[model samples]
Target: MDHRTQLEERIAHLTRHVDELSEVVARQQSELDRLSRRVAMLMAREAERELDTGGSIPLADQKPPHW
Candidate 1:
């Protein structure tokens, strides 16, 4: 009930919240790294496919008909 006790409780709660958020950020970072690698792999595969098809320009670089 004292001021000092209330401050200590608030500090404890804030510390716990910060720790939880840090863990969540770490998990998100790990997921982002995995997704980035997967994207790179997919891009490489697509580039190979384009080359095999003997395309002069990549499909991604081609303009759509609506353009």
Candidate 2:
């Protein structure tokens, strides 16, 4: 094949690969957004529970158990 035709074929292949990678990135972003919303909801619920029970942040975020 001529130089021009070979170059065009390579360009088309690279373009298709880029398009596929773009689709994968978009899907991951969508999943991350959904997880963020879920975490926000859980935090809100925990805060409301703390108000009713008068507790502090969970032991996970607290000082060492030995202290």
Per-residue lDDT of model 1, residues 1-67, tens digit only: 9999999999999999999999999999999999999988887788778988997776756789899
Off by over 4 Å in 2: 56-67
Candidate 2: the clashing residue pairs are none
Give the top-scoring candidate (TM-score): 1
TM-score of every candidate: 0.84, 0.75
Question: lDDT scores for all predictions?
Answer: 0.90, 0.86
User: Candidate 1, TM-score vs. the true structure?
Assistant: 0.84
TM-score attained by model 2: 0.75
Report the C-alpha lDDT of model 2 over 1-67, residue by residue, as the tens digit. 9999999999999999999999999999999999999988887787777767877774334579788
After superposition, the stretches of candidate 1 with alpha carbons farther than 4 Å from their true spots are 57-67
Candidate 2, residue 53: how far the Cα is off, in Å = 1.0
